[model samples]
Target: MRPPTVLQGAPYPYRANSLNLFRLILAGTVLVAHSFYTTGNGEGPHIRGENLGGWAVAGFFVISGFLITRSRLRTSAGEYLLHRIVRIFPAFLVCLVVTAAVFGPVAMLMQYGSLAGYATTPVTPLQFVWSNITLYMNEYSIGRTLSDLPYRSVWNGSLWTLYYEFLCYVMVWLLGALAWFRRSAVLAVLAFVAATAAHALESVINVAGLDGDFLLFLKLAPFFLGGACVHFVIERWGVNPWIGAGAFVVTGALILGVPGWGGQASAPFMAYGLLWLATVVPQPRWIAVNDVSYGFYIYAWPVQQLLALGGLGIGGGALGLIVYNVAAVLLTFVFAWLSWRLIEHPAMSRIRRRVVVPSRTGSAAA
Candidate 1:
């Protein structure tokens, strides 16, 4: 079949408003969940129920699918691909390098001391280099203990999710460029299918005695699918307020364990997504302009780790840990805001200008 032509239409309302806002909110939620996990409160060592923030990574993918799909449908295939790579890759590379510089030396020092007299500690510089460059640590966690790679072991536990997000971006780009799966409706359904299938496959693999780490992708499918489903409903059908509100309520109820709570622990996220969509009717200044959600999400883990090592007792009983975590969350917001203002925004502006879209009515390019 001949390739599908790019659609020349007004930007979809849901995507222009609700989708981006929801993504920021979801990113914030993931950060909060991570803060809880890193704080070591309520969690009694053996992988407690509150690890839901990890799913935020998956939610990110779904948002990406929808947004990237929207971009692909509107812009030329080359411009679409360029936009995503420009938006994501530069910030990612900077973060990766910063993380390496901060943690690499500390790790080397610790290993040096440990093997002062004995054979050089089995430190593989190659592994550290590769892991940071490729974000491989996120694929499967290693260095589970405090003694293992003490300084750099968990340098950025969250980086793994970035890798998956990048992969999804590429997938969407190819689909758009090749004009495969051109319809938004089909893409949405396919998203749901991919998510559900991923989950089923994970469960099946686990049952068949496969390694748990290998099943990570499966566990993350639902959240991504959920986001795509949201896009499909809002953009395709043009969700009315009543229906949106009803969905908000139903998703909330489901989150509260009404009809089969497979991952009820991640209910907050589902609620967040639904409510986020419901509020897309455009109230001026509804969300804070300088929302530091990304900063909070990415930086919280490292701050928590530092707190743990500082003997300030991050894992101390409930109240103390809570307080420590709260402090970290606040600090993360500050850094995130700074990063956005200084690094991310500057880069995005420059890149966005490079792929400018010409106006339809012969107006000046946007």
Candidate 2:
């Protein structure tokens, strides 16, 4: 039940937090991409399917695959899951709480005029906690049935991917735990292939108007597999960092130019390429330090929604976006620090306490 501690009392390895830094940038990319939706621009060159934001998602998938696999390789399955939950949930709950506090009441009053049913809404503490903790809320419920309204769904739409990432974690963990794959490298390839097949099938279904739900599977699996490939290549055969970085650039360019082509298929190759560069890059003291990216990603959408509700509109073009980003950045940093200090760290410590069996028990078992 105990969560894993921070990489051995601070000063972690070189690549430890770099992917997280990349995720921060990707979160911003998603914001900008979604801004297109908010702006009512349906189709345009810069805001097309292959926009920066799409790439950002790809990056996230890759990171998840690589890191989760690495975590399993380095620790026990129980510890890996605990670390993930502790790192992810506390800040996530905080975000839900803050957003609901700032927006739920105001939106209710503005729309419903009397707050008659505010207590029953998704933003209510009970609803938010229940929906988020269970993770199946999104799948089972329709609009606002879970913890989000229709328009407000975008508030944390980025997290939809996290659900899939969680799935990926389970799959990867099972594969490793069961010794299903002869090598991590083989597992990586299988994941990529599966993801690619899923995506291609989804695209076919969408084109035929058969279904849209399949898109979810297509998007989630490949990127995750891609990340795993990167980890396998580097950790196993020891590919050159520069070669990896260059491959990443090339693959990235291809995807940007033609995003509709089974992007999930290409992500693993690209992720490994980029990861190669990550390995070669000099480890800055700052990079290896604490990561604030997850906090940024989880909180930004909710904060932006709250800001919009407050009439601090992020609609004045580039300047407005900049202002929103700055405010979100500051708030996210504070949240991350608090989460690390008060909630995540303390909870992890408690878990550790529970994990270490007493000497009497150990002697008896021995």
Candidate 3:
């Protein structure tokens, strides 16, 4: 069978498939992975060295790389940046306010004697909302809010990745602005190779006990670049099920066989596999219609923390832990749905109206 063709110069068909559902599943995987820690049980399952949450996050970056690159290509820089701001900041700001001002203060009162104590806490304004909103420069907790729990101190542990996601977005914009993306295939190939090499070097450095924040970026950057490379080659490669299956098999084998090098080795395969599943797999209509993934992802950690603070698994054992996780999942979904309908969607629509600009393509591209 001939490979399917996706024109490189064409705008990415954002509504063509069920990428929304795929992202939701990935977000759900992150929730499940965090359950182990949130419930004070243990770490979740890992394939090779990366845990389920890590894999899901990598998948998110991959998809972002592909879609955002296409978005930048099809629109002006100002418009691209505006869309990103509208997509990320409004809902994120809302979540920050709810978590820091509302839930966080309450948790603080529960932990400390008075609201005065919460107000005087160092992390209350500085790290919690200010740093996170500015650039995610600080960690994701305020005061001793969740300190009493088994997990301790951390509020929304899932947020560290947002900084890296934004960093990737900036990188794509810079590269596109420099005309690197407009060059011949050789530049794309070189870029991909450089990313892969950097990832490999990061793994080596990690093994050598020199790991740090910068190394974390190095580790995840390859997956993002791999997705971009796939987009560059989409016209030539298409959505071939056989090829996707083959890639999945290879990735699984590498993860199982060379557990240490598995994640780095599987980066390209993971990108291709995710794309294939997003594009080729049959999607339910309901999943296609609603996109609660971003909301779910942003709210889940706090919801789980709230449940834990409410005495979820004090002495309840395994059964109690299970109950807590299940409840958290359900409540998280509700919160996500509400966020999408009430905050995220409406905000985007309003922002679009205010910041309207004609695309360079002379048509709106998804």
Predicted structure with the largest lDDT when compared to the true one:
3
- For model 3, residues 86-194, the per-residue Cα lDDT tens digits are 7877778788888888778777666675777675677764457877785574766687678878778888878778778887777777777767575534555567677
Residue-by-residue lDDT tens digits, candidate 2, 63-126: 7777777666655678777776776666666656655554455555654456665567444545
Best by TM-score: 3
Q: What range of 10 consecutive residues in model 2 has the weakest lDDT sum?
A: 357-366
Query: Which scores greater on TM-score, model 2 or model 3?
Result: 3
State TM-scores per candidate.
Answer: 0.70, 0.75, 0.86
* Model 3, C-alpha of 33: deviation from truth (Å): 0.9
Q: Per-model C-alpha lDDT, please?
A: 0.51, 0.58, 0.74
Work out how many backbone clashes candidate 2 has. 2
TM-score of candidate 1 to 2 decimals: 0.70
- Clashing residue pairs in candidate 3 (N, C-alpha, C atoms within 3 angstroms): none
Global local distance difference test of model 1: 0.51
**Which candidate do you rate higher for lDDT, 1 or 2?**
2
